[model samples]
Target: MNNIELLKSSMINIVENKYSFKNNGLFQTDIPNLDFYFSSEPTEFNAIIYEPSLCIILQGSKAVGFGEELYSYDYSKYLLSSTHVPAKVKILEASEEVPYASLRIKFELEDIYDVIKNIDTNKLAMNVKSEKGLFFDDLTEKLYEPVSRLIKLIDKTKEEMDYLAPLIIKEILFILINDKSGYFLNKFAMEGTVSNKIVHAITEIKENFNEKLNVKELARLIDMSESSLYQNFKTITSMSPIQFQKKIRLEEAKLMLLNQNVEASEVAFAVGYESPSQFSREYSRMFGMSPKAHAIYLREEVS
Candidate 1:
């Protein structure tokens, strides 16, 4: 078999042999905030909103839609999200013979900042954009080796986990920073950096998504000019500030509708829309179906 096929086979073997699948569709490990998965069926369309994280797929393929942009990657690629963004992801390919397996590592900004303190700043690239939050890169053998090793650690005893997991995690981050796209990762660690400012703005919007927000006020809050905020907000989030807020609102609405059976009008008002008609218009545009219809579709799919 070719290299890609070999990598796929090895990854599937490691996951199935070393880890036990949990009810939540992930394999548990001793390491906190780290999960693994091996799947053989296409995943349903779902939204993922999370902090800085890395996802490496060892086999099969998945598609992620961020705003109007769609990214598809397989065994040959990996994905990184530096900020919380509303995205719809679906596994496009998997099978019992060639299951789709992935490793997901979540980390706090402070941990990364602590690690950056000892590293030389000169190692990072000079030019980095604040608004470029998601990235995908080609996978190499070097990168795959450590992932394989990390999976092996799952079989070790608790004592071994304490001594070995931290080292493995550090090494993984080191590899990421040393790669060609390391500049983006580096920017995430720098305080008061442009990317950090954008992150701050994102935090504000997330916390106050239901509140009426104006461009001028948000720009002032982040110490940026309104025009600059508009430009950079689009750059970092791939959407304008209003668009970003609407995306967050719609995502939350989807969750509420699915879990709480919230009426469409109540959901609209709860998420900051003063006009139900306008909310429905935007919601349908983003999700492809009206809120009521989407809710029904989700319920049927889950049932």
Candidate 2:
């Protein structure tokens, strides 16, 4: 078999062995930045936070929607989220015989900055139109080999991991910076771009999601007009700022209710919803169930 085929086989083996118990969810790895995912069957669309990360599917397909754009990635392609964006994702292909399995590596903004700073500026500039924060591209041998090496390190000693993981991660970053899609991400490191400004607003929203957001102030902070901010932000994230905040608030409320068994009203307030009725209405709309019912369902699933 070819190297790509071999890498896929190895990735499937490692994930199936390590994540045998988790059939349709994320499984954390010992590596700080890496996470493994599996799905035994197709899943309905669900809201999720897409952090700055890269993901490669070894066996199945996934569809991620942000605003009007729907991105599909399978074994032949990989997904990249250059910045944090709230999106609805679904497992499009999986079965008992060929389960969906993938690996994701989360990287910090600083990592991208480091890559851009060290690389030649002339080489970085291209005429590519700025796309959304997310991208999908064909898989390449250069990315596959380093990812395979990183997964192999799961069996190594802590001393070896301590010494090797960072080197591998840096290598992956180098590959990403040199890749064609790197242009989508490279704009983030450039200071005066509209994409960079939107990212700034996103960071602020994430940091203070629970507080009431002032759109005028946010636009001023980013040195853009209110209309421009809304248009460009939605273009990149597929959601208006208020919509983004509400998505995060409801997501956080779901976690709090699921983990702590807190009253829905309390959870709603904690996540910045002033009215319990409004929270329940919006929560039901997003998650397809009232908070109480969703929490109970989640509890039953875990039990």
TM-score of every candidate relative to the true structure: 0.81, 0.95
Give me the overall lDDT of model 2: 0.85
Q: Write the per-residue lDDT of candidate 2 for residues 249-268, one digit (tens) a residue.
A: 98888889879968999998
Q: Which ten residues in a row have the lowest lDDT in candidate 1?
A: 19-28
RMSD in angstroms between candidate 2 and the native structure over all alpha carbons: 1.7
Predictions: Cα RMSD each: 3.6, 1.7
Per-model CA lDDT versus the true structure: 0.77, 0.85
Best by lDDT: 2
lDDT per residue (tens digit) for residues 185-272 in model 1: 7786677777777788888998999998788888888788888888877887778888788878988888888888679999999999
The global Cα lDDT (0 to 1) of model 1 is: 0.77
